[model samples]
Target: MSSAPVVVVATFTAKPESVDTVRDACKTAIEAVHQEPGCDLYALHEADGTFVFVEQWADQDALKVHGTAPAVGALFGAIGDHLAAPPDIKFLQRVVAGDPAKGQLRA
Candidate 1:
């Protein structure tokens, strides 16, 4: 696989009553993801009732592996019904510009 780093943003909207449940599941998965090979960043954020995950990986191969990791499976199983809809996942490509450090995600 290519060695280019991968960036992903996944958004999940929780049902009003299932907010805590979804958050808990995501936190559990984040802990496991942090220990995975090639994981650079796996952070969670929330606003209103929407949860967002911003992730960075070493390369395409690593990202592919992460997609099928046990943590991912557990995360889905735990929060599947709690989500308002299917996750909104986006894979991104960086465009280099001035101030390289400020322009792109570290790691």
Candidate 2:
């Protein structure tokens, strides 16, 4: 797998009646996120009843900027009232893929 300084994987379960609303709410922010300087990937997927977002950033600073972006706030405001529960989010590091394990980081 390729390397990224920051990778985010998030999951959100929309209250059955709120899926469309959630998806629509995320459009603006996702569009703007794709235009950000260090955003290598910002893809959303739907499976079962959950929405998932996978993101890659050039570095930590870039990720931090995304946290404060205007579109981000707008997105939350639009969807905040409809989420089934709070979004499940995490920052990850790729350590293994397929059949191999890569070297570990010491820091």
Candidate 3:
């Protein structure tokens, strides 16, 4: 674990027909994830009709655990075929936030 927070940006594009289902599914999943331990923030956003997850964790290790959780794994597995394309996910570290700060990302 580190002092800086871990951020995750994930995007999921839905097939036109699966948009509604995808939205509903992600909403349910995101809400559940919000209650997870070490989760600082787990929010969903819509980006050009794609579902975007903007998340913050207490640290990298926490994020790793959450990523592999049964809940998360199931959601992804269940929705894989419904997605318009493969999910786009990126792990990030804050550079300048909350009044001026800088940090680095580590694997």
> Which candidate achieves the best TM-score against the true structure?
1
- TM-score, each model? 0.97, 0.83, 0.84
lDDT of each: 0.95, 0.80, 0.80
What lDDT would candidate 2 get against the real structure? 0.80
Write out the backbone clash pairs for model 2.
Answer: none
Best by lDDT: 1
Greater-TM-score candidate between 1 and 3: 1
Q: Give the per-residue lDDT of model 1 (tens digit) for 1-107.
A: 88988999999999999999999999999989998899999999999989999999999999999999999999999999999999999999999999987999998
Ordered by TM-score, highest first, the candidates read 1, 3, 2
**Model 2 lDDT tens row, 15-88:** 88888888887766788988887888888899766888888887888888899988788888888888889988
In candidate 3, clashing pairs total 0
TM-score: model 3 vs. ground truth:
0.84
Q: Which ten residues in a row have the lowest lDDT in candidate 1?
A: 98-107
Query: Which stretches of candidate 1 lie above 4 Å from their native place?
Result: none
Model 2 ranges with Cα > 4 A deviation = 1-4, 97-107
